[model samples]
Target chain A: MKVLKGAYSGLIFLFLYAPIVVLIAFSFNGAKSRGAWGGFSFRWYESLAQNADILHALRNTLIVALLSAVVATIIGTAAALGMHHMRRGLANFMLNVTYLPVLNPDIVTGISLLILYVFIGINLGFSSLLLAHITFNIPYVILSVSPRLKGMNRHIFEAALDLGAGPVRAFFKVIVPEILPGIVNGFLLAVTLSIDDFVISFFTAGPGVSTLSITVYSMARKGIKPEINALSSIMFVVVLLLLLTVNIRAGRDIRRRAQTHVRSHSPRALSSREH
Target chain B: MSELIRLVNCVMAFDDVTVLNSINLTIKDKEFLTLLGPSGCGKTTTLRIIGGFEVPTSGDVFFDNVRINDVPPYRRRVNTVFQRYALFPHLNVFENVAFGLRVAKVPKADIERRVRESLDLVGLRGYDKRASHQLSGGQQQRVAIARAIVNHPQVLLLDEPLGALDLKLRKEMQIELKRIQQQVGITFVYVTHDQEEALTMSDTVVVMNDGVIQQIGTPVDIYNEPKNAFVADFIGESNIVPGVMHRDCEVSFAGRVFRCVDTGFAPDEPVDVVIRPEDVRLSPPEEGQLDGEVLSVTFKGVHYEMMVRARDFTWMIHSTASEPVGARVGLSVRPFDIHIMHRAEKTEAAS
Candidate 1:
């Protein structure tokens, strides 16, 4: 039964990755037609380097992702803190409303934001695109951070204040450090959503401001370029490298925690000596 | 000694649910005081008010004859050893202990010296570099104590600082905390739900329940002469029975009139009578005050606790000897052992 379950999961993994794997494999194809298996070459990678349009979209994607992630993290974490101390009924109501943008269809949220921007007479360019990205990203940030705020011990903050730190100092010294893991998680989630977004960016971005996802969608109309495949392959490698770093760090933390547990309960502490 | 802290007419209601009701309390300088009560008894809320974490709804808190109602916690001359030992997880023991000193902007050399001294006092020497998670619960508690004491606050508030420890460690830390309190001569206001912990470590134990102070006295006074049935039952094992005060030095209980020392009640006034478990003695049915049947007997390590039913009252008796179940026995109570008080409005039935 266990082996059968393992085989099932393996098949599911292959099904999810097969297309991306094929795309990456075709990025090395010497021929332009992705359907035919051409001999391996770096021709597409060289062409990808020369593709300035794709480069501009990539730059736009990075800027939007970075700024939106940071701004959304600040706003969302502050909102989570405010909700942490609110009355249960009101907090529940606000939390339910916060989930509305997240649960709604992405197209609906995108078009609604676009309509609001147009009504306000704001041009649909970098600023509007950034604002729309931040608006959609904040709900995800709040969802990830709210649980951490709820789990924190309220007395810990009071302890910080009682230790002679002022309210502002205590917040930075105690509250921020305690909720930092949640904040980073929220920021990373926001960045991924912003980078992968197409429907939202397509609606809000003007002609000069196109993200990588929107660029890919537009390129699909004209025969998809081999250089786009190369770009996708590069992005896959970058994401893989990021995941590798994050997983290694998380594994180290778990091991360090286990080692600390063993050392503390080791019958004799051996007194961690400092010279 | 003069009062170091005074809470006058303090009333705290959180979202219309009263947690502390018109509490008037005073803390003397250089004394170890403990607030002892069950959960939801408002002991912790009172401590938070003194620590300046909560402003009472309609009362003034004074420190050295100065009203500090508007003063924030950082400006108060107080530090706290939190219940869970809220040590900063990101900092090592040395840094956690030095946090208060650094906040006050003490000289770096002095901060180091004081942190070392406080850690040494808690017998956690050489634990400076250890991370908070790298220490055991007892060690974490010690670090918390060291951190609070390093600031040298005029008053140290401990909110059940030893609530999370094994019995042996809890006992050892109780004595250790009392020793540290005396050594520093800092007014320590400790809160705990454990009656034994409060009695063992505190110079004065204030027993509170239902957002009101039941009684405040030394351990001996509180134990030997409880003000009401709640104090008697909460402090230790007791056999409480309804009785009537006929006059001064006279009372009727267990279906018989008995002489007693307590007085100042109206004639034939219904009262609550308290007799400690150890005070009830056993003898042959022919040679005692009241005859009863032995319902059960159980060994309680130091002594065997036997339940004797005399008339309608089931008396808990503590003795070294054992009587078989269903054996006829006589229960005796000396007049001096019987403590009486006017019946509390919320009478508690004793089993």
Candidate 2:
């Protein structure tokens, strides 16, 4: 039964990832013909390294991602805290409004943001692209952080107040620390979404402020180039490493907290101690 | 005794439902006053109003002589040890205790000294570095107490602080809480649904029901001399025998006449004569006043709880010796132990 289950899982994995594997494999083809299997070569990778336009797009993408992630984290954390304190009906309505950007079609969101920018007389540039990215990224952060806030014990805040803390002090000392992990997780999620954005960036970015995803689309439309494959491979590796790091850190934190909870609440441990 | 806190004609309503109605109470300084009631009887609501978490719909809350109705919870010179201790999971014992002092911007040395002193007072001095979540429920509750008292607030509000513990832990903590209150000499406004807990720890007990104060007096007064049917039924295990007041000092129940010490009721007024189980004596038929057959007998350690059926009603009697089931027994209650209270509807409504 276990072997059969393992086989079933293996088949599902291949079915899901086989297309990506084929794309990566074809990117390394050294033959002149695109369809035929070819010997491996480092020529595509070398060509990718020399592409100054791609490098510039990559830098712009990184800048936009960092800017949007920071802004989204700040705004989303504050919104989560606000919603946490609000009445249930009002909080739910506001949460739905915040998440409208994520649920709306990308093309519609892109067109609307473009119209908004033009109406506001703000020219498309790195700032406009960053703003557009943040509009979508913030909802994800808020969704992530709000649940963590709800799960936290409200008594902690009351305890802080009882211990003589004013409102502002209690928020920073108790509320913030308890929700830090959720904030970090949300920030990373925003960063990933911002970096991978293409359609929204295509509409919002100016000629010289193109992001890496937009550059990749333009390059792919021109021709099926091996250099694009090399670029994608690198981006995929970076994303994989980032996801692994985040998952490991989050898992460790959860495990540590669970162990601490168990140790403190165990009857044997509580009764054995003289104090 | 001087009043430390007073609520004058306090009325609190949530939306259309009134939770506390025209509450007038004066808590004396250094007194342990308990608001005792069944669940959802406005005891907790009253305590929350005193803690400044809830504003009264139309009334004044006074701390000493100052009107504090508009004060926010953080600004009130009162602290509440919540039913759930609500200790900060991320902070250690010392930091939890020191949080208020730190927020007040006290110096580091002073914060350390006060935190240590508070922890020592709660018998947790050596566990300073232990995380709040790394403690048992009882320990967490003690830490909560230490955290509140460290601020030296004028009044400490405890809202069922020991309700979550096991029986053994609860009894132990009750004694500990009494000792701590005596040592601190701060006004304690405790709210609980547990009648025994209120009776054991309170200097004064306020019995409330359905958003109105039923009675307010010392624990003995509230328990032994309940003023109405509700108060008599709620405070302890009572065999309420519905009867008619024959005269000023006489009541007729179950086709029999008994003399009671209570007076002030008009002739032929419907009343309930409350006899506590422990106060009713069970003996052989010749030595007792009422004769009945034992329906059941439950051994409760030092005493036997016997239920005797007399005429149309059953009465619970506690005795030193066990009475066999189906055995004829006699029940005798002292005239002083027979507390007579008027029917609830006839009493004047509190305004």
Once superposed on the true structure, which residue ranges of model 1 sit more than 4 Å away at CA?
A: A1-10, A35-38, A240-275, B348-351
- The true-versus-predicted C-alpha distance at residue A192 of model 1, in Å, is 2.1
TM of chain B vs. native, candidate 2: 0.96
Locate the minimum summed-lDDT window of 10 residues in model 1 chain A: A266-275
State the DockQ, from 0 to 1, for candidate 2: 0.44
Lowest summed lDDT over 10 consecutive residues: which window, candidate 2 chain A? A266-275
Candidate 2 residues lying further than 4 Å off, grouped into runs, are: A15-50, A89-128, A206-208, A249-275, B346-351
The TM-score values for the models, in the order shown, are 0.92, 0.90
Give model 2's docking category. Answer: acceptable
In model 1 chain B, which range of ten residues has the least summed lDDT?
A: B342-351
C-alpha positional error of residue A101 in candidate 1 after TM-score superposition, expressed in Å: 2.3
Tens-place lDDT digits, model 2, residues B1-351: 798899999998999999999999999999999999999999999998988778899999999899999988888889989977787877888887877787788899988888888888888879999877768888988998998998899899999998767677888999999999999999999999889999999999999998999999999998889988788888888888888998877888878888888889888988878889889887798787888899998988998888899888899887788879999877787789888987777443541
lDDT of each: 0.88, 0.86
